[model samples]
Target chain A: MPKQVDHEERRAAIVSALWKLAGERGLDRVSLRDTAREAGMSLGQLQHYFATRDDMLVFAMDFISKRTTERVTARVLALDERTPEAILRMCVAEMLPLDDRKRQGSRMSISFYVEALDNERLLSHAREGSRKLLDFFEQQLREAQDRDEIPADRDPRREGMIIMSVVDGLTSYCHLGLHTAEEALAMAMRHLDTLFGAAHETKR
Target chain B: MPKQVDHEERRAAIVSALWKLAGERGLDRVSLRDTAREAGMSLGQLQHYFATRDDMLVFAMDFISKRTTERVTARVLALDERTPEAILRMCVAEMLPLDDRKRQGSRMSISFYVEALDNERLLSHAREGSRKLLDFFEQQLREAQDRDEIPADRDPRREGMIIMSVVDGLTSYCHLGLHTAEEALAMAMRHLDTLFGAAHETKR
Candidate 1:
């Protein structure tokens, strides 16, 4: 029997190459040929995976969403007690670009986001991804309120929206060199501390 | 002498055309020919004002910074009382894309910021603008502290950065359709309220 690998794994490898290229150069400079070259695959092979630039872009954007979900899921699973503030902090931190890999991921996301502002298909894809993330945040906030981890009087949905905004805002600031990843993370954590009450205080 | 006007005014008109184009389409779609057509000027005339695409981009970015400063200046001038919270609220609100005109300005700024991740000249231009805005926020915070408008224990520079982050976050959310302009403004105001204490309480 021939050695076999999942087609999804192979496709992800190609997408990874494209993601790296996107970080090094702007997304505008990417082409099928360049992507093929970066991926160490033949042009014909890349063509089999993505028929057009838009196809690759859509796939890349989707891949980014999946990557983020996976990271958040892993973080949530690893938390020991699953306290509301702990879980929230872990989830928000994962959303931020706190390292080189995350930073590159964020840059690609922003590239697609700006592109989506003009492209309808990309816009829909971007919106779907955003909604999914917002849903996750809202759900977590609701859980915290249910557990009495935070004040029940606070509206989870509104607070969820604010948390999401702070993440995106810090991401933008980091990209512009206004804040380092560490500083962005610290600022975000401070916002959380103030919102949920300090971590230790909430834990008690 | 032939009829003459300030060269700066002519350049500003050209920049305005580019700004409109950027809003209608993403910055990636802009080109010299397209900009010339949009401005109703010959390529030669546009060239006389801006020698290269990069030159035009830099000038356009500078124009954006100047326009924002002018708007903030006008708002400050019109204020009846320049208390720290009042001034800070005005500044943060102005930074947010709370209406169509401001939204377009923000969209253009984000487009340039993404481009700047790959382009150094644009990065420098963006950095300068961000620094100016941060300086304005910090100065207002300090002034507020001096007047006892807020607690003196708070670090003005750090608080200034946090406020800036919230503004960018809300702006991104507004663009993504997660939050309406009014909602974004309200959320920002709420954050300010929390940061400075409730309106009357902070006044005391």
Candidate 2:
């Protein structure tokens, strides 16, 4: 009997291929034929899982969302001796395209965001991903407050919104295809320092 | 002979119809074809001015951007007696769906943002809109510092990012099709209150 394929890994492989394809061009240009070719799989096999373009897109959106959520989970678990400011800086820094994997991920996600606007089926997934990310930020901000890295009276909800907005704005620097990743990070760091500096924090 | 159509009025009519369609559905769903029909003009007439679909979208995007800039300018010009805190609040409030016009404008813009992500063609228009909005916020924050509505040492860039993010978050309330306008505005107001209250600004 043929060895049973690992379903999770197979799904991940397909998504990675699709995301890479979408990133290289625009999501509008991605097709089942291209995805299958990129994955080195039979068209029959690709269709067996996704069956249609919408199905593939929905799955790919979910895949990226899951991967990002895992990153947030890892950060939460790793919070140790570092200050909230340090941890936040590091966590946000990771979202930047400082390396190939991150750059690809950011590019794919940015492209997906554009597609999500017009496509009814994709919009919900995109919106949900944003909500989850914001919730994670809220949780992290609360942790920082609890750790005495932020003021007790500082509203976690508002702070989280502010942090997320700054992240969105920073992405525009790259989205413009103008600044180097390092340059964007530096600009972001300077702004973050002004907003989240030690001077602004109070011990619990 | 039919009264010669006012050149500017015809273009404004098309743009007005385009925004109305965008608010009712979205940017993607409403095509130039739909726009022509809505404006009671022939497809040829629509093509006469825009020349292509891209041209139409660019015009629509600029239409929104121009109107917003004008409103902000008018508001700034009108501020004679209110404190800086009052001014910032008023400016920020305009971005919220506190009324029908703002809500419609936001929903339409959210729809366009998806396109702006990767369309290098579309990205600059979005960036221009954001820079104008942010510059206004930054200017206000600086003025507030001068007037002591916000902390004197507060960095304008960071403050502007925070404000912009809050506006983006509020966009989710409507664009997500999840929260009613009232609920979203309430949540936004709560967050805004927490943010400004934390600063503990001095009276004018």
Error of 1 at B190 (Å): 1.5
Whole-model alpha-carbon lDDT for candidate 2: 0.70
What ranges in model 1 sit over 4 Å off?
A1-5, A40-47, A198-204, B146-153, B198-204
* Chain B TM-score (model 2 vs. true structure): 0.81
* Per-residue alpha-carbon lDDT of candidate 2 for residues A91-131, written as tens digits (9 for 90 to 100): 67877788888877777775666567567878887777777
Q: Which residue pairs collide in model 2, if any?
A: A114-B114
What interface RMSD, in Å and to 1 decimal, does model 1 have? Answer: 1.5
What is the CAPRI rating of model 2's predicted complex? acceptable
* DockQ, all models: 0.64, 0.26
Per-residue lDDT tens digits for candidate 1, residues A1-204, read 998967798789889888878777778778989999998888888889898888989998888787787778788888897876788899888878888878878888888888777787877778877877778778888887777666665667777877887888778878878878888788788777666662235353
DockQ of 2: 0.26
- Work out the TM-score per prediction: 0.89, 0.78
Model 2 residue B22 CA deviation in Å: 5.0
True C-alpha contacts between chains kept, each model in order? 0.62, 0.23
Docking class of 1: medium
